[model samples]
Target: MWPTVSPQSRSSPSADGAAILRLEQLTRTFAVGDQFVRALDGVDLQVAAGEYISLMGPSGSGKSTLLNILGLLDRPTSGEYWLAGEQTSTMSDDRLADTRQREIGFVFQFFHLIHRMTAVENVELPMMLAGVPPAERRARAREVLQRMGLEARINHRSSQLSGGERQRVAIARAVVMQPKILLADEPTGNLDSVSGGEVIRIVEALHEEGLTLIVVTHDQALGSRAHRRLLMRDGRIVQDVSG
Candidate 1:
């Protein structure tokens, strides 16, 4: 069963009512053997605070490229990306790193916990990197782990935990910093049906608690769960629908 998160325990949506992220004529191109290939072409998107969205497309359709740019992991070839009303394209590398660390969290298809680290340690890693005090980091790590229903496994190494447990730890780690935007890429691709269902429920719960959730997935069922769905093809968004 999924754990229930109290509203008080979650971060509230942006109070001033601004779009959390916006992309204006975004484009990304990579040189493959002296030939430029456009991965994203003139993409425009606006994500409001607390919106739940899904990006779906076939292979090489630019889904990953778009996500990377949104997460501040990649830069657009020639376009503007605004985050929290700030133009990110002009920010220095340090500013981008700080913004990415503070505003966005990510979960990938493969659980990326260090095998030698305990669940709590994995969760504490981010806070530690940000120079958080040791006591606060430990407390916050345990708190989020407990929320993920992994209290008992908090001290266990990643290698000692089951797939579901490890994924839960990863989720705990991702949100431990309380990022406003959570980007998930094939979050359930590595899990069985039961584990995947549980993971889905957990992320949905976070979305309900006011995190801006954006998911990139191939599963139609998973993609359909978003309130807004985007379909991409040939380096451009072909369809966008909201219900």
Candidate 2:
């Protein structure tokens, strides 16, 4: 049986109306030889729906680990994780897999598109997995691609697109499922300033549409754009501030 989280517990207000994610003393550790390396140290964070937050840090500061945990690609070694009002810390792999597919959108520095797949097919990947019909997938993929300014690139293979085009396609795919949260890791790391800003626009548009968004990057300029910023180093947050 699933554990119950009362509706009232889900109603915490953060000026944005509703809390979307909560991390309580979240910690992650890895063993290396005789040493135990702490990747995250007692991190506590709360992200509200429609909020845009950023994580900035030096390399090895646990930003990547935090992003992976949020995206369900990795689990914390210790601490509680509440996502969309559900406790995910104890969920089985199957449950966790389902949660990720249904609730989270992910963008990464590499774009991570299949080089051989056309833009539309990549955009339709999630819908296809959820058993959405081919016709619906096609319609949704086309709709989202058009919104991302990739209508004409629908049939182009990833290799045929420029870096910006590819990342835009990636963003289109990530949000096609209407995920409750979008997690981006260094979304603009590989693009030039112009291309970077374009990606930021796309993310901001999503935020405007009421999605909870978190960006993890090393770029201070990019992090500053978020309403809330967390600065980290050597696996722990050194500072957390909001504007």
Best by TM-score: 1
**Candidate 2 lDDT over residue span 1-243, tens digit each:** 011223542333253456678889899999999999999998887777767889998889999999999899999998999998899987999999889988899999999999989999999999898999999889989999999998899999999999999999999899988887899999999999999999999898777666678999888888999888889887777888878
Q: Candidate 1 residues 116-216, lDDT tens each?
A: 99999999999998999999899999999999999999999999999988888999988988888889989998999899999999999889887889999
In angstroms, the error of model 2 at 118 is: 0.1
The TM-score of candidate 2 is 0.92
- Could you tell me how far off, in angstroms, the CA of residue 88 lies in candidate 1 after the best superposition? 0.4
Model 2 whole-model lDDT (C-alpha atoms):
0.86
lDDT scores of the candidates, listed in order: 0.89, 0.86
Consecutive 10-residue window with the lowest summed lDDT within model 2 = 1-10
Please give the lDDT score at residue 185 for candidate 1.
89
lDDT of 2 at 131: 95
RMSD of each: 3.6, 4.8
Clashing residue pairs found in predicted model 1: none
